[model samples]
Target: MTKPTLIFLILFSLNFASISALSQKPKALVLPIRQDVGTNLLVADIYGRTPLKPVGFVVDLTTRHLWVNCETNYKSSTLTQPKCKSAQCQKAGTKYCHTCPIAARPFCHANTCGYYLENPVTHQNTVGELAEDVIAFSSTNGFNPGPLVQIRDFLFTCSPSALVELKLPKGVQGVAGLAHAPIAVQNVLASKLGLKPIFTMCIPSGNSNGVIFFGSDGPYSLLPGLDFSKTLKYTPLTISPFDEYYINVKGIKINQKPVPGLNISLLSVKDTGSGGGTTINTLLPYTILEGSIFKAITSFFAQQLSKVPTVKPIAPFGLCYESKYFSSTLLGPGVPSIDLELEGKDAVWSIFGLNSMVEAHPGVLCLAFVNGGNEYRAKVNIGVYQIKDVPLKFDLSKSVLGFGGPLSGARTHCENFNFTTVA
Candidate 1:
């Protein structure tokens, strides 16, 4: 054989080996029987908590199934009849072979019926028919067999012990015990999407009287980009330096009264040394107007003790305000309002300002305003300024401080004085 031909053959063999290895690697397994069991049956007792009330009992007739015997108590009974036998053998006086009625059977007192006879050759056929007949009879007699509600399965419950048993279809191997079955099923369903489990709870079934508990799972991280669907309703206003950006947002409704004092502090994702961001307590005395949007701009001043040829790299941060309207009403003619509040920390301002400076070199300013917290107006004018440029001691009357809004608007005024210094 030629040298080149031999080399090609060796390479081909190596490629085939690699492909075989790749095919042998295990993939995520998704089990077929993944459904909310909580909704299927009423969970009277959880594993760790108090014992559950008995829902029902199980009757197993499987031959040689000793496991069933260990879990249940068995009882048996017999029937007997008595005959009037006096002088019948002597003179036939009041002698009779008394007939006993069916109701007189002793077995009836023990809650049992006639014993079932089994044969070796007919074992499979007989047991199969017996199971069907038992189920049918139980159903007709108002006894819940608790058989498999779905295919290839069977269920039995021990109400007294709060025990439940599940029988998988034949040939399906290695079924987990009842305690861990739900978790196993959950892992299978989540494998395909690479999702993590979160809170799990039982949701009440609409049709059945029972509750179905499904594990609610999601990705650990929020999607990187801003969620636009959550943003479209509220307008993103401009931010300024030194002026703490205060946002008061409310919802609007037709022919409803205006709501007031629905205010929230804008927060920044970045971390500042002082726990970065404004909180509701710090912004006290400022009332959030109902149905109106409040945006307060503040001034920003940068002071450098030493002037250098190179520009100092400063971290810029600003606030991102989000409002969720819980309820709203119509105020006056065509006026609307809502109830809302803020969430998160105080250092958010610094982080937001730093990021803002890094991304866009917008001038820093501080703004304030006064308006009713309950009304939403058509339009308003907000003030903005830089802290360094403003006079160290300026008269309130001379400065452009308070905000202007329509009379029909809520949130008429704002008050909160706190600041943080970061080097």
Candidate 2:
């Protein structure tokens, strides 16, 4: 071959090799999550800024956008505001222009994409500028983490410092929205990376850290050779107009016995848009049931555990028992299991002692569920405490929620994700 031909062949080989290496790299993103001891909320550490500083964001299940306070001492060289008419602003479903009385700064800019952001804790609303910045995350191949990858133009919002309420835990600068909205971090990752619209979360119950995996369907490998994905049971996942996730719970049972006096109709979403239905939330620490359902379940639960010595009820907890009377098992205090029957056959999510019982005081153990006041929208609101230790796979494209039964049943837990190993 001539010199030019040889040179062309060499260049082609180098180009092919570069493309092959890029393809082999993981397409998934992983974030290490830890439960906030003070608020009982979940928080994920995200890498931001040039030197890669870890920013704490409280994970919000229903928040529409990931927003951070940029009022004071907030600095990011990569931060850029999307123009009012830009595609990013349109994708965010907002065309309003943000204005500020204060001089121009990070959040105070002219003709910027404006968005209405809310504080999940205090329910306070504020209009903020929709901005983009370079954000980094650890790449994973389902089994182990790969190199740290950067998203050059990540979409998010910058709000005033006042929106950061006291209800949020200390050191947490913002709220990471994981809802179905376009601007949500998960949806943004899916659209920008061309990966599957799926994310898995393992919320740890104790002090140990948990994890969130975005953009990959996985064999959610935990310790001791266990893969959470293999054991998952899926149910139809619905979304409300506000982008909140809802699961169809057909019925409830205690120890294989149907919970009596339950108005099963209330479990279905109403067409009138008034009330009724069941939804899940990470913000709520304990599950809350409607008035009638609460009464029925609490009465039955108390009757089932009649043999266990009863103690005076603690505030917010209707029933309490002497902690010493119950024996501890792998799941928790030995008690009858509660089950939420889903849409499909044998589609039951069971709650063992670990999630069913809560220690109210030094020697008092109470039911982990709460009584949603006399009038409430959703009949049953499943909370973090009830779903703790379970692996959740949310498939946005398919509109399905996969639940991996309590990890303790398999002698593993959410904290088992091997974060120490980097691919």
Candidate 3:
């Protein structure tokens, strides 16, 4: 072949290979589960402040099926709150007795015990059989049962490695990072033991905004390490994919002027107490507006900022706003009040006005206003401020099946996993 033709053919082949690699990248599948509504029964049974064996089961409320795997099926027992026959019971002339004297077994008295009968086809000794039963029960109930995402298959090949990458939705502002240690561990346990996935948010130190990542298990690195105690604390809001969690801050103003527009920017400032300072430290650019509350910004900021070192210290820092608009002088000089409005996802917006005068040194102030005989306010402090309040919208147009599937081997220790971004 001619040299020129050969060179052109080689370049075309390389381009084809690059395109193929990009097309085969793994994508995230986030399934939201309502921990409050659907998992009520499970929570009552598991976290009822009573110590019990960690028995896992799937309840498909949609199908009205209750699948359980206990060491013994005592549902037919005539005794209410049945207990093992003790020596005391024997001395009392009864082989066994109910713990409560007034306790009664209505099902036993009614003789309608068909539901409590054991299945003769398979003894409940095997884990696989128990899982099947649980799945069946879940299907019988109205609670929607998600498709069977094989634990081994899903985690094994969900990504090229065990580590997964997450990005904040556009319009949300905050630093990005790993979820807190306890939250991360809880999610991992839920996926491994409860066979469920969870979502969580984290913040970086000194920053007021953050982000959320949805998936089955928490990142391994997010678990308790040598410095677990130092990690930020996270509050689990809702347990479903449909519900969004947020934080709200009140009483903020811009140079004594109420922030006017629906979109507001959170900027990180250095030396907040100074009368007029311009040296600004910009962290993560912008975050989506989930709600019109400062607490929501705080929640998201704490989660995502935990990952990036440059933005880590900002998590714990307080937010400050200029009480007067274009007043140049701090609020202590009696400047006019300014109001700011921030918008998150779902068209939700929060308003905070700077009403209080700033102290000589850096500190926080609240912008106050009265409505219907009730006063409302937003928080504005003098410190570092990060941009927050945008829509919670993400781009999923370009996505591929995430790692961990049939092609991948069984789940391995997280130490064996590694993640690298494809630029």
Candidate 4:
């Protein structure tokens, strides 16, 4: 017999796929995220109906599958994986296991259907069985009493093990997948909530809390009047082979002069598996530049510090100088500006320097661009830190991505949701 969880998954998917309710005026929800331990992750409550203590999940755009910490940690006791020989198991038989390259999954020794996920950057693995349950985001920035949005019969995995070296008690437990795939929590919730297939992320800066807004340009957004989406720079949004977002880079300019090093082939298959691999990820802790581009920027930094005494390099960071001796503004107000090639001149998304400098220690600021390895799959990322105080709008209806410039001074984070302010 089919497991009840698998049955619910099949029924729930079938019900929503052909629903008669047409896409109405888009509804929007803005949920604030947590910046735990330098990683910009969305920490939200799971399973609103259950009385279980809340656990936090990382809302990473590169994660392709929804999963929880452990089976015992799972709030819903009824959550179960389809047994071997079941249709869900049969489906798993066709898909490749990245970890066990020799065989496909449901290579079950135990009767449970299972899979393992491996993250390339952190080299961590989350192993578990597929299951179903409900997921909910708390209303007020994960601090208040009630759930803002709750969806029942949600399909996800229950993982009991993870090889996490950086795990902390006030840190990530599970990953909330947001890749543009069937299993992505963002896509699933967008469909169920009657919202647009779009969202926006803003970090503002190093001090403030960030928020993710769903349906940025639809009827739900305050674009024309109160919102800053209208004023953001624009570019033609492209998709990777693996269903992640990509943007075109026409060229990079250093102090208004074109830097020829950025013009190179950066083609790489991103989001190749169930884990993080997107080229430009908001949640990625560091910004990565293609090798040649990284060299160009560091060399520019070197010339600026030629007069200063020898500065020791920080591990992982190729360039670092004591900020007390050197001006924190060595890269200056406008050093490296990336010119993104959009269809028209008006749509270009120019880059800035405030996003590139990293403060590693007391009175120390380093150019934070990591050298993306020589592999064809390596990607250049505009991480959450690089886009500080800027708003990135993913407008599905227009198939365009908007990137706003930094706000004047340190802008305070926006609070409260206004459902009545329909556009």
In model 4, which residue pairs have backbone atoms overlapping below 3 Å? 204-389
Error of 3 at 304 (Å): 27
lDDT of 4 by residue, 1-423 (tens): 113223323333343333233233325555544455544544443433243234566667666667666533445554455665666545434242224334523322345656655443464775566555555543222122122444565666665444323542244567766666665665666666766677777653543335567643632122123356556666666666566776655445554555555434442323433322225675566677656667876676566556655467775678876666644342233334544444445665555556666667876766667776554244467666666566677765566677776543223232222322211
Tens digits of per-residue lDDT, candidate 2, 171-253, equal 78899999889989898888777878898999888777777899887867887778888888998888887788888889889
**Distance (Å) between predicted and true CA of 361, model 4?**
2.8
lDDT of 3 by residue, 1-423 (tens): 223223323433333334323332112222111111221211111100011112222211111112232223212111222122433222212332223224532222221112211211121221111111111001001111111221221110000110111221121111111122211222333343443333322222111112222342333121122111122222112111211122222323443434333223322122223211111111112221213334434333323334322222222223333323223332123333233222222211222221222222343332221111111111222111121111111111111111111100122211111111111
Please give the lDDT score for candidate 2. 0.81
Error of 2 at 364 (Å): 1.5
| Residue ranges of candidate 1 with Cα displaced over 4 Å | 1-44, 47-258, 266-423
Clashes of 2: 0
Sorted by TM-score (best first), the order is 2, 4, 3, 1
List all candidate RMSDs to the true structure: 30.6, 8.6, 22.6, 9.1
Better of 1 and 3 by lDDT: 3
Write down the TM-score of every candidate: 0.15, 0.92, 0.19, 0.71
Evaluated with TM-score, which candidate comes out highest?
2
Determine which window of 10 residues in candidate 3 has minimal summed lDDT. 153-162
**What lDDT score belongs to each candidate, Candidate 1 first?**
0.19, 0.81, 0.21, 0.52
- The C-alpha local distance difference test score for the whole of candidate 3 amounts to 0.21
Superposed model 3: Cα runs more than 4 Å off: 1-151, 155-189, 194-228, 231-241, 248-285, 288-423
